[model samples]
Target: MVTIKDVAKVTGVSPSTVSRVIADNPRISPATKKKVREAMEHLGYHTNIHARNLVAKSTKAIGVIMPSSADKALQNPFFPEVLRGIGSVIHERQYSLTLSSGETEQEILAEVQRMVYGSYVDGVILLYSRVDDPVMSFLQERDFPFVMVGKPFEKLQEITHVDNDNFTAGKQITNYLIASGHEKIAFIGGSKDLFVTRDRESGYQSALTDAGLPNNDAYKIHTEFLKSGGREAVERLLSLPVRPTAIVVTDDLMSLGVLSTLEESGVQVPRDISLVSFNNAYLSEITRPALTTVDIHIHELGAQSARALIERTVDKTVPSRRIIVPYNIIYRNSVSEQ
Candidate 1:
């Protein structure tokens, strides 16, 4: 219950002087500032951020918006890696990170509305971008300062985003598998609605076409961003009479699931079917057969998103930015020549 007044009384300075010290006004004499700070420490004083926010019209905090249905995908290593990157910048700027996640679109959009109208955060960062997303529509409608972590399905010129060159990643990984002597390659990706999935799938197909490899419709599969999703897709694909000689999965976690299903079915990787995937996440190297994956620089994606949002918050007139982080393929023991 000790107030600024208590610090002012103890420090023998005016209440305004204590207030100026708390705000780091720089106008206060250094000697007086030191005494006021010491008195604040002795009084266990904390500045009222809420009151300051009212005056400054900013909370100095950023709200992160996860995918509408990220309950499962959020558990993946990608989110945490990106968060580390986002934290690196936001913390340096003395801003706090707040998260908004929900299992449904309505729930997620509602949280976003609360953040926007309630003045809870100075900016928002969306971790996923998809086609026809309501939350995105709302943000666009409000002209709120926000940044997306992936390509916007619409309003490309209006939305600022940071994304990986997933198409090139898909093509490079696919090309690598083909060069290693695998022809009958299958692709396992996430939901079709996701920009990431469609871009990667397009790249995979382009590589197949350029290499004169058969781009069989049956070889392409889409599933949830979950481990079981990989298991289920592989189970179905393995039952095909013309099984693929190799697989190009879109995510490392799903690749792990595919590896699990292969083990349980007595199908040896590389020896039976070479595998390549993306994300280069933590689990990729630890499996019995280390996976060859595309390193999409997940952390950079987050950092750039934070940097973009902070920039927009500072100067709303800044032109929208589209940052594409680079990717590279990491070869390991997962693939062998067919």
Candidate 2:
């Protein structure tokens, strides 16, 4: 039953001053703001966010649109870690997170539109970046505030995105395979349309070329970056006349699938075929061989994305930013000398 009016009366300040204090407005003097805050705490004053947002024209809620049908969002180690970072920063800032997923592009766009124009969220953070995605276009056309988690193929200078040097990560893994004495190496990747896929593939190709190795199309495979996809890619690679001695999988989940198929096919890991994967998911560590993979700092990626989105939302005058988190290679039992 405690209200702003009660706190204002106790603190000898107007209700509007109490409101500004609650919002941590810099215009309010620190001493007055501290007094108002203490009065609010003493009176157990709770804010009516709906009414407040209506007055301020902001929901203080950020909409997060992830690939709903990916099914792998929860199963994928990278996403959960990134989410943790996002959640931590949002919570600390006293903001709310609204998660949305859709089966189709139209559905996702509809959800985003609803979140924005419907006044459900002040801004949005896209979890995936693709070439000319409708959702990205919609936000850009209207000049709505948003941030993407991956780089976009087009309009690199126009939009804000948070990502790591995926090209370098891919090349590093490929170089590791080559250093291990594996002349024939294969690749299992996610969707070809994805920017991450292209960046990684480019890295893989660059490493092969630099090492004076032939880049065989037969050794390259494109999959959904899931366990089943990895399994299928491995099956196809094994059926080839010249099988690869090692493989670089773009996702840890797919790597697990490849390992499962390899085990069933009586291929001893590192002894018969070495493997390297990305994301450094928990599954990587739990695998029989404890996969050697790249750590993309998933949590930090999420946190940074949230921060970028928040900054964009709050300060419209700030220029678009492209932030690159760091990555490292974690050596483990999944890779061995040829």
**When superposed on Cα atoms, how far off is each prediction in RMSD?**
8.3, 6.2
lDDT of 2 by residue, 1-338 (tens): 67678888999998767766664544579999889988877777645444545666887889988865446466676777878999988998778998876768888899999987898887898888877699999998989989889897799999889998999999988998999899999989988878898899999999999999997999999987678999999999999998899999999999999999999999999899999999988888999999999999888889888887776665565567789999999999998899
User: Cα RMSD (Å) between model 2 and the true structure?
Assistant: 6.2
Q: Say which candidate scores most in TM-score.
A: 2
Off by over 4 Å in 2: 1-54, 70-72
Runs with alpha carbons beyond 4 Å of true place in candidate 1:
1-56, 68-71
Best candidate (score: lDDT): 1
Give Cα distance to truth, residue 314, candidate 1, Å.
1.2
Task: Report the lDDT tens digits of candidate 1 across residue range 218-328.
Answer: 899999777888999999999999999999999988988999999999999989999998998888889879999999988888988887787677556666768988888
**Which residue pairs show collisions in model 2?**
none
For model 1, give the 10-residue run with minimal summed lDDT: 46-55
